[model samples]
Target: MYERLDKLRAEVERCKRKVEDDRQRLKAAEQKLQEAENTQILADVGALNLSPEQLADFLKLVANGQVGSAGTVSTVTAVNKETEVETKDDDDYDLEGLEDEEN
Candidate 1:
């Protein structure tokens, strides 16, 4: 009977070790997933090509849920392509600089 008990204890120890190993693997997988998500967010924001100040201002606007001049809440949505947001009239922005950059 003691021999049987010893074998059972050994089996329990093996099972515990396996559970600990699985927990470690799960933690690693979660960390990897979080890092990948961060990278994807950075890539998405970087694709906007806005300057640091512009990006900060845009983020603040989004956080505040405000739209331009209307003082209304903004709606967040996903788009597969870049959409042109007409913030100002053509004369408001320096087109010559944009033209220079295009060349």
Candidate 2:
């Protein structure tokens, strides 16, 4: 009976090790999947930074219209340019509330 109990205990210990190994493998796979997703998202963002003509064609398709209105296209371009300028200006100055903190 003692020999049988020892065998059972050894088997249980082996099974626990196997379970821990499988869990670690699962965690690694999930991390790889997340990294792949992040890489794909970056690629998509890069694709969007195309030339004006290419961007206009893409927008037309996304809007489901054969032709986008000239005014709308101009407005979007202007807004993008303005935002770039604004962000550059923002970088020249420290953030308002953060700079004034006592700490």
Work out how many backbone clashes candidate 1 has: 0
lDDT of 1 by residue, 1-103 (tens): 5999999999999999999999999999999999999999999989988766666667776677654355433343322234433354335666897899999
Single out the weakest 10-residue window by summed lDDT for candidate 2: 78-87
True-structure RMSD, every candidate = 11.8, 13.7
- Model 1: clashing residue pairs? none
The candidate that wins on TM-score is 1
For model 1, the run of ten residues with the poorest summed lDDT: 77-86
- Return the lDDT, model 1, position 87: 54
lDDT, each prediction: 0.72, 0.64
